[model samples]
Structure formats: C-alpha cells, structure tokens
Target: MASRDLVTGKIFSLQTIVGILGNFSVLYFYLFLHYTRCKLRSTDCNLKNLTVANLLVIFSKGVPKMMAGFGLKDFINDFGCKFFFYVHRVGRDVSIGTTCLLSVFQAIAISPLNSRWAELKVKAHKYIATSNIFCWILNMMLNIILPLYVTDKRNNTNFTQKTDYGYCYVMEDGTVTMKIYAALILCRDGFSLVLIVSASSFTVFILHRHKQQVRYIHRNNLSPRSSPESTATQSILVLLCTFVSLWTLSSIFLICLTVLNNLSLWLRNTSALINACFPTVSPYILINYDSRVPRVCFA
Candidate 1:
C-alpha cells in the first residue's frame, strides 16, 4: 500500500510539474511579446487575460501539489493553506469569467450588421473592464464563505475514513445542506457550460456563413485577402473550441464527484487529474495556436 501510494504521488507530481511549467512558459511568452511591442489589439488583450488567469491557477494549485508530493506537507502551514486555497478558488473563478467573456466577444465580433446583438459590439470596449471587476467581486463574495466551512484539523483515528486528506469544512448537519451545496455548484457550472456551448455554437455558425460568403465572392472573381478578418475569425473560433472542451470536461467531473459521492478513490483521483490536466495543457495550446509565436522556436 505504501509503495502504491508513493508511485501514484510521484506520477501526479510529474504531471503537476509539466502543467505548471507549460502554463508559466505561455504566460511569459505573451508578456514578453506584449512588452516588446508596447501595444495589444483587443483580441490580444483577451488572450493575455486568459493566460494570466491560467498562470495564477498553476501557481496556487499546481505548484503546491508538486511540493506536497516531494514530502513538503508541513511546508504549507495554516496560513499557506488558507492563502493558497483562496487564490486557487479566485483564479479558477476568474478563468471561468474570462472564458465566458471571450465567447461573448467572439459572438459579437461575428454578428451580422443587421443582427440585434451587432449594437453590443459598439459598447463592449467600455464594459470589458467593468465586467471583469464585477466577476472578481461576485466570486470573492461567493467563496468568502468557504473558509468558514473548512479547517486544517486532522480527522479522528477511529472515524470511518472517507477522504484521507483533511481540510476545512463545516460538519454536515444532514444530507440537506450537502444536497444544497451540490445543487448550487451544479447550477453555477451548468450556467457557465451553457454559455460556452451557446457562444461556440454562434461563432461556428457565423464562421460557416462567412466562409460561404467568401466562396461566393471568389466565384465572382473578388479578392479574399482584402481584409485579415478571416484569420482573426479563425483564431477566435480555435480559442473558443479549446476553452469549451477543457472547461466542460473539468466541470463535468467536478459535478459528478460532488453529487455522486460514491466514486472510488481511484476514480476520484482520475477525475481530479483530468480537471487539473486541462489548465496545464491550456497554455501550450495557446502558444501553439497563436500566429505570433514561432512554432519551431517554442518546440
């Protein structure tokens, strides 16, 4: 049992390291490029925000796991515990908010002039800052209550052990509160998932239409490269597709673990690994997909 645990921990540690390094590299590349250029278009701003959010998650969550795997359990003291968990929660919330905003922006960018939502694009720049501020505040308020529930105290030796680890949490009064918490989490996740799906769907439809239009113009012997609109559109579509796929899988696993509660230890860990893997893999995808990055150099 000890050997098995050690091996599993080692594997998880390696995975976490990969994720952290990859995410950090992505963040640094973007920051370096932006500083050298001294300016970013609106799309670059969105991508930069996403990269920063992912970097925060890597620092708060991924790095800690690597330390813990190397027998640094005591390194994360009570203060570290609270601070790291808080940052991890906040970073994850920011990622969620940013992804939703990215989708909305893509939809607006692609909306036809005659569409009702077309008017929204005109005012989007004004609200971008405000929206991010609102998301931060809302998430902070929602999760401020988490510390009230969790604690660093170890479990009693004689208690029927469900989870091997200990953290802060209010004692379950009954199944009712657990159910409520589960339900609330599900609702929040579901809402985000819906937005992602809706936005991605709209963007795809718009892209299809735009492609048809381009083909039509080509048939009429019109030049297609007159505007760089197609390139930009394709980039946004890729971003949306990547965001939706990664987040949706993580959200689904979280929902299952929260609601089902009967999942085995291996299954739970597998779900967690999947959830963590996405954030780690996300940075590499951004780096590879961004046209500005030299592929061979990064490779």
Candidate 2:
C-alpha cells in the first residue's frame, strides 16, 4: 500500500470510530431519558433525529471511504454502491433540513410576545414530529434518482462517461439535462441554507435583546449566574456556527469533486474527511452543551 493510502485509512478509521461512539452516546442518553420517563424538552426530538441523520451519514459515507482507504475499493458491488450512495445523499440532506428546522424552532421559542413569531412559539413543539417526518420524506424523494446513476467501478469499463468515487462509479455525461438536475439540487440546498441563516440570525437578535434586558439585573447584583435559557441559546448558536462552517467546507469539496471530469485520489480523500467532520464533531458539541446528558450518564 502507498504511504498516502495508509495515512488516509488510519484517519478515516479514527473518524468512523469517534463519530459512531459520540453519536451513539447522544442517542443512548436520549433513549435513557425516554425509558426513564424523564421530562423531555420539545427540542429533544429534533436532537434525536439529528443524531440519527449523523449516524446515517457516518455509516454510509464515512465507512465506505474508510474501507476504500484500506484497499477494499473493489469490495462493493453495484447494489452496495447504489445503496450506500443513495443513503448518504438522503442522510446529508436530512441532516441539513433538521438543522434548519431546529434553528427555526429555537428562534420561535425565544420570540417576544409582541413579535411576529409569537404565534409560532405557541405551536412549534406540536409540529416537531410532523416536520421531521416531512424532512425525511422530502429528502428521500429528492435523492431517489441517485441509485440510477451509481454503479460499481470494477464492473464499469467506460472511463469517458464515468467518475470514480473510489468504491463506486458515478455516471456523468455533463449533458444539459444533468446540468439542469444539478441546478435544481443546488437550489433545494440553497433554500435550506437561506432558511437556516435567517432563523439563526433571528435567534441571535432575540438572545442579544434578552441579554440587554438582563444586564441591569446582573449589574444590580440580583442574579450573578446565567440562566438556563442563556446556556441553551449558547448551545444552539455554537451548533449553528459549527454546522455552517463545516457545511460550507464540505460543499466546496463536493462541488470540486463533482465538476472535475477526472478523479484525484487526494481530493477524494480530503473531501471525504471534510464531509465527515460535522458528524464527528457535532455530537461532542451537544454532549458538552446539554446539562442533562451528564446527569443521564451518571444515573
């Protein structure tokens, strides 16, 4: 094996291990809360769904990359390639949608009574399940076309019309129809990103306003410590920042890979690493910010 491949394999192996453990920790903590009849917040549902989506991304994207890195590139057949690619695309889209949903809900939850979002605040929690279900359905439908375009690399002899994804071959002709389809996919992702940014901005404004109101209390030595609301707000803000940053980086890598007619193994490895970064790091953010997680762990 090449030295570069060995290094990539080790790195992916670590990411796969850490991401799985962290996400499962979050899932286990939430499941424990549920089985124990612990009081759950409305946002907990979103967190759980997000964790599941992260797991899906890790298993479908990260695991395959790891296997490829370890010289198992030819292990996957046409069916496996299609299945993994399809699941990864669906999982990634769902993750973005869930994050957007969570951000909007947080903004609504913090809205002032006289604000335009007040009405949403009262009914937001009620729609969490419905919203999550819709997100899954929408993404699944959107990415159903992936399987048709993906096949095992070993089985394909054509090099002029296919892009190698290490373990799978993506049939791309750069035709007008394919370009239009790609544009539509970009539009869908762009819409989700816009919503996320707007919701996050609104949440930041509300938090800032609340902080200003509470400044006087702290100044008067009334309440020296921060409120639980403040902590939760900080968590959401950090989560949004982390997601946006990683999402931007991953998108760049993905676009670079997609537009290139030839496959560069280095670019492919780097892209896979960037794509897995959010899932690997996000669970740690949640674990650190959520006060209840430690309690459940100790219990």
Top model by TM-score, which number? Answer: 2
TM-score to true structure, per model: 0.80, 0.96
Q: Which stretch of 10 consecutive residues in model 1 shows the poorest summed lDDT?
A: 161-170
- Report the C-alpha lDDT of model 2 over 160-237, residue by residue, as the tens digit: 588777788888766786777788789988888898899899888878888887788877878587676767778978
lDDT of 2 at 269: 81
What TM-score would you give candidate 1 relative to the actual structure? 0.80
Q: Residue 234 in model 2: shift from native, Å?
A: 1.1
lDDT against true structure, model 1: 0.65
User: In candidate 1, what are the lDDT values of residues 1-299, reduced to their tens digit?
Assistant: 25544555676777777877877776677677766774444555566677677767767766655555455555655566667767777778777777787778767876898899867877776777777778778777766755443344342434332332223222333456556755765677678778877988888898888787678778887775635455656666676677677777877777676557546656655665665665677667666656656732454
